[model samples]
Target chain A: MPAGKFTQDELDQIYAFAVDLGRKAGDLLMERVEQRIDGSDAPQTFEEKENAVDIVTQTDEDVEVFIRDAIHTKYPTHKFLGEESYAKGESREYLLDAQPTWCIDPLDGTVNYTHLFPMYCVSIGFVVDNLPVIGVIYAPFQNQLFSACNGRGAWLNEKRRLPLIRNPIPPMPANAPSQCIFSCEWGKDRRDIPDGNMHRKIESFVNMAAEIGGREGKGGMVHGIRSLGSATLDLAYTAMGSFDIWWEGGCWEWDVAAGIAILLEAGGLITSANPPDDFDTASIPDVKLGSRLYLAIRPAGPSATESGRESQERTVREVWRRVRQLSYSRPGA
Target chain B: MPAGKFTQDELDQIYAFAVDLGRKAGDLLMERVEQRIDGSDAPQTFEEKENAVDIVTQTDEDVEVFIRDAIHTKYPTHKFLGEESYAKGESREYLLDAQPTWCIDPLDGTVNYTHLFPMYCVSIGFVVDNLPVIGVIYAPFQNQLFSACNGRGAWLNEKRRLPLIRNPIPPMPANAPSQCIFSCEWGKDRRDIPDGNMHRKIESFVNMAAEIGGREGKGGMVHGIRSLGSATLDLAYTAMGSFDIWWEGGCWEWDVAAGIAILLEAGGLITSANPPDDFDTASIPDVKLGSRLYLAIRPAGPSATESGRESQERTVREVWRRVRQLSYSRPGA
Candidate 1:
């Protein structure tokens, strides 16, 4: 499908459908919230083989199944890649080919939901030949809906267009230290491996970020570090410039698929843990899994040439170079 | 002043005064927001000082002066310790004495304010003989007011009591790994640091935490780390049980003064960065300056026996031991 082949009316219909589905999911979540509040349902109850953490509630399964069924029934010709159905040894061919496919994560922050933290969301992305061209993220808790359609620009809550902030980011003084904030999982892998390299890499990254951004050198210290426990929300916050930089490891594609589209559309940059051979859409999948690292910098004004996008890229690369060699091994490995 | 010395009527008046002051300061901030939105006033600007981040805003100074003046004029007998004045060499003796004194950080989380991040607050605490007996923290952006009296429970918005979660925390399994979360400043002190030991400490903490909490560990890994940028709000959130643990260095007493009172009142614990010390009222100070560290933990569940506290204490000690030997030295050092 060529870029201009989709007419404006078709795009509008798709946008409306996506928004409706997002709202439907949010409404279901609200219903669940009411059930929990009314004691009609317990949010989590154990079943055999699945730990409480591993168990997906009926809401999770039902929501995903509903979306998949609805989409497949409505658009039988379209391909689908969803979180719940992907683990049955399905091939990635749909995503590999240049066909239009829907990538959906019914719930982006599941732990938050289990704990009732109110930071979770429903994420949906439309990909053409593996490239995200339409993104919809609905955070029911915050009543925030962020959507973008390639060249149409992004919108918050359908009415408010997200005008990109174009303020000039002051040039970071030469020799000025830089700061970094990274997020990683505390997976259940501690026991089998006594020596943890992830620990070393994190230590190195924090130390270097602080050192470069701290007081002993020409640059001021890095601002600080934060781990919010939700990748989608983290990426969303980063895209809005509430945070300066975000680095991460050990996250799945669903965790970042919709967020990646939003981040890229917002003019933010995303790259692999290691420098990419080329900075383009193709680099996304490689950077999505936990195997690769990601460095995302919020967009800055072009007038501040020295410390603009290029400078930020160089700074990130330098920070990566300083800590890249630190080895990390999984416990069993 | 003894607990019963003040009549119920007098106590009511004091509460009213504190609440009014908080609201007034909040209104001033709201005005600033409107002005910024209307393009009538510029957002607060931030500058880097020697290893420190500084924000110069009329709101901060104005709010501080307004609070101090109102207190002084109304209760001239009461002593006051505030941030802006302290920077100009105010005495710490007032805070040390047993007399009723006020500790205030008119604009907590100034960095958030400068960046329009919506996490800043106005914190006010009342201490009699160094024991924080009253606390009022108001976050205008979120319209949240966290308040508490010595014997009374904490409240948010004067209606909802603290510890919003209704469910009991699950028991800690015997096989549970040692996992923790910490919050700290990336102070403006990077200029003199050469080796980036601070970064190393962060890497070490994150790695250790991840290893202990990550996959392959018997017990699940620690949840994650977060930095909200304001000690007052951080401590308040801890008191609310939103975060299990908090550790911070490079902040002042006013920042944590009110929050400390609220935490203790809520049955949480706090100690200096050194081995776990008593978190009794006597141990808290009125003002803490550069190079101080703190550890705060919300009380564990009924299942946590004396042995459980002891085990948790030992783990914390081990973490500190690893962290203590590490330091980020200035470039020349």
Candidate 2:
């Protein structure tokens, strides 16, 4: 397939548009929160998506519609894929192709938003030829904005270049888990089926958090375990090098498409969250937006003995060895 | 024993001094982080506290000394209890007494600070009559300041009143766990002994996170579980009503003293993290500053049939029924 092409001017225009739209959407989110806090807005009403814990509020729907309308008005020819629209069955088929497409998660941490937890964001990504190339994410609660494109390095609020460590990014630790601050999610999948996603996720969390020598050598004894309840923020934090690793499963392309672009631009690595059947001969697998599983590591400093990529790969492989094999797929796939 | 008495003017002066000191300490923390990020500061050096996962840095000790010196110069007669002093054996005996005492954790979330994860803060707490009477917590990274004194309501940044809900705080849900956002910690303890702190903590996390109606009804199915790696911030957020419930074990008095003061002033409730042997007859136990285990809930709005305290207690009792009884004591206690 031919790669979708865009001139330098066009790419710059798209990036600017995404950033402007993200900030505007973030403003709308802030307005809603403030209104609710002051009792100006009525109590929020929500509907369950997959179960009781997986929810969708009217603001999510409103924000998606707002973004879609603005995008359609500005770039009438561009195709768009958004979480709320997809959930509503407006897009019945997978939309990726060798074309320019906009993927968006209007409110990435809806649960956090509903609970006023201050970690939610507005994520917007531009994809080209099935690759995430241009990304913009705005977390209004923190007033943080992350943006990146294919070749240009990522930035925080359009000023500070990421991995945020202007110094040489430190190399991954020799014993990865013992020295790594890892982030993961207990996603919507809550089933207890043996070896299923939830069961595997719980087992993986315990293994990573257990003593270094206990649990029959499966203990990761990581520096810390954090669950921010938002994959977008988790990936963004990883891109900025605050979190050294992020492993996630059972989320949609819109949930991570933008974060993946920023992370890669920050010189990070992305691979399948699941390990290979045999590590002796297999290289780490690449992660696609639709894979529904991913493992991300921050940019590593190059050492005399190993290149940055080599160190990252070694760390990924070590982590893979300690975690359970996880499986997840899109609904009805 | 007589209660330590303070004139209203004295209390007001103390509160102002604490807030000023906290901000100054926070500024120092921010300066250090920026220096390290810009490669202008020397690489951080740390000493392991309990094990590899628990660490202390020069900044923690430096900040503590700075605060202690300032307190001594201004209030020479007042006693002081701080994390670094106790760790260094400066004050050998337990100092909680009916005296005007200042308890401080110079840099809470030291691990996150070292990693530049941006959840750290300076915590200054004042105790009188063996009670946390005035509290000030400053998170410079986010520029959030939480302060409170007895009688006067809590404030965020000295402007917004907390729970931050001016109208009325929402009542606890009837089925508590299913609607609560819980904050917990995977602390320095990593022992996997049967029913040990680590063992019980992991089990409780899994139980609360599992699907409802799973594992023979032990599944709590809470809305979300967040581990911020900072008990001080956890308690502060709880005081602000951002987190509905925070259950913590194996933390220090300096870690929670200030936060406890703010939480109580915000109309929240604090109790033991452990459940009693007989729920039918036992009342929820009160949590002391050095209890090492605590369960806190947000301020509940009164309902037709139940007052705010009753609602909070009911919710606490329900959560207690779902979690395992955890035991933790200070090392060599």
Candidate 3:
């Protein structure tokens, strides 16, 4: 074990705790959903965040409070950062230090929750030295649980090891985008400026979906584009090999931290959503948890000409070239 | 019983048969999926329909053949219309007459099917006098079965009656778009003309997702936009109250006939995806099975000022005005 780091046993314990906590949070969400559906719930109310499209509900707050308390009671010395608490804080600082911190998004799909869309989930990530090491995500409506500990591999329902088809993951095609099932979101930012984040995002989506040789030669014509409205679940699905590519912007650390750990453990790659300065470079930099920009690709199988990492790198570069670069800034950055 | 129509008992029998057939087709699909995932499936091959994005696989054809044969054997006099047969036919006529016909998309969401995305399903619809009277859709991966019989009701797994929250489904808000979870797809038509069908579709999507008071008053600021790549499943979700609205174009009758029957039975409304000639009319024209354009809204809760149908109609008009009218023509139309 590293000098200041927890060993394998401790990490497994943390992963187990987070998985249980995630399921508990998911139960709370299901209860609230039942109340809302059965007409026994309190007054229906939602507080707008960035705009009407971005909203928060009482359930989100309540569940976050419960998760925070549970974590604090179990590990009193660990720092905490959650979506609700961060939104309520006065300072609004972006802080991720060397100490262990639990990143929690009690309800990742708040709008889906309010609308009863059944894609929402609870995401809990334990971060050490600013890197997600233990991740657990539970989608109760689908009864799917995804968790991963660093170097321990990702699992679905603690039963199936992921990439779900791990025996020989298919090698990404030469023209990656043409065969890719891309996952992206129309994020909280709704500005329609000509080349603003929203405009660029939509343009990127169009470029990817448009026919080949169209859009001034920018079209990639991906197999399909899906927006499930929950970053955590999107990454979890990508990890399990259902979705081939996930590109996102304007999401927070709590929204992606757990999914990132799981995805990485499942042999996936995460890079900056934005285009790099040099396309000729062999490697692209990994996106930071708070970068608010990300592009993830599932692990590739054995290829005669290219290794799995090379295939993933080629995909990232090819995709980056097709879609318009997007810019999303943190609240205080 | 009407002179030319099947009696209630006959319709119920047909419904039961369709449900059984749907489950069998779903089982075939699941087996093929397992074979593909485990690397034991036959050599992968897909035939292009209109273009690269539009594809048909061997499994799709095989499932359709199995279903068609079963239907013809049981109901010798009934007509049949299915996606594969239609594509293979030379006439390519848009035919929906007075005859009793079985409309089947043996496998909807073929792209999802090939990609193992789990949103694919088997949709079986029975149409009489150009109206869908019985609907059955089964998603093997999700193990969900949605079915309905005209004048009877829609059901999930033949148990839970839909809107899923039937006690009192929520009424559409005064400003529906601001709070709606809209569903649309980037269909096979991927041209990039400035004001063409694909262009307008993209523009409408942007308008629906943009910030309020933006995009020249076309901004809808909807809570979310989801694309599941499966029209049948989309309509099923909307019928069950998970999605607020669904607008689609370029899909065939086999894609939506079953969903239409289910949605109508669930107390929802369907209108043309294109705008009407007179918005002031008391009732909008119901879209035909072969319209190539459709708009669907979930059933609304009881309201003092307006009935559920009225509320749904209002939402249809509101959404029609927000999205650009797309043009989708059938073969030889």
Candidates in order, TM-scores: namely 0.78, 0.96, 0.96
Expressed as tens digits, the lDDT of each residue in B54-169 for candidate 1 is 54467777898999999999889988988877766634332336566888999997766655555689999876656676788998866778887777777778875565443443
Tens-digit lDDT string for candidate 3 (B155-269): 9889878887755677887788779999999888887777988888888888888888899887888889999999999999999888899998889899999999999889888
Candidate 2 per-residue C-alpha lDDT over B1-333 given as tens digits, one digit per residue, 9 for 90 to 100:
222588767788888999999999999999888898889988766899668888889999889999999999999999999898788784434567778899999999887887788789999999997688899999898888999988777999998888866576877777777778889988888876778888788778777877888867878788888888899999998888888899988888899999999999999999889888776458877787677889999877887788889889888877787777878755422
Interface Cα RMSD per model, in Å? 5.0, 1.4, 1.6
Candidate 2, clashing residue pairs?
none
- What is the TM-score ranking, best to worst? 2, 3, 1
Candidate 3 docking classification: medium
> Which has the higher DockQ value, candidate number 1 or candidate number 2?
2
lDDT tens per residue, model 3, A1-333: 621389888888888899899999999999987776676876458999867887899999999999999999999999999999898877656777889999999999888887777789999999898788889999888788899998788998898788877557777778888888999999888887888988889888998988888888888889899999999999998998888899998898999989999999899999889887676574788778888889999877768899888889999988888777777776543
Q: How does candidate 2 fare on TM-score?
A: 0.96
Model 1 iRMS: 5.0
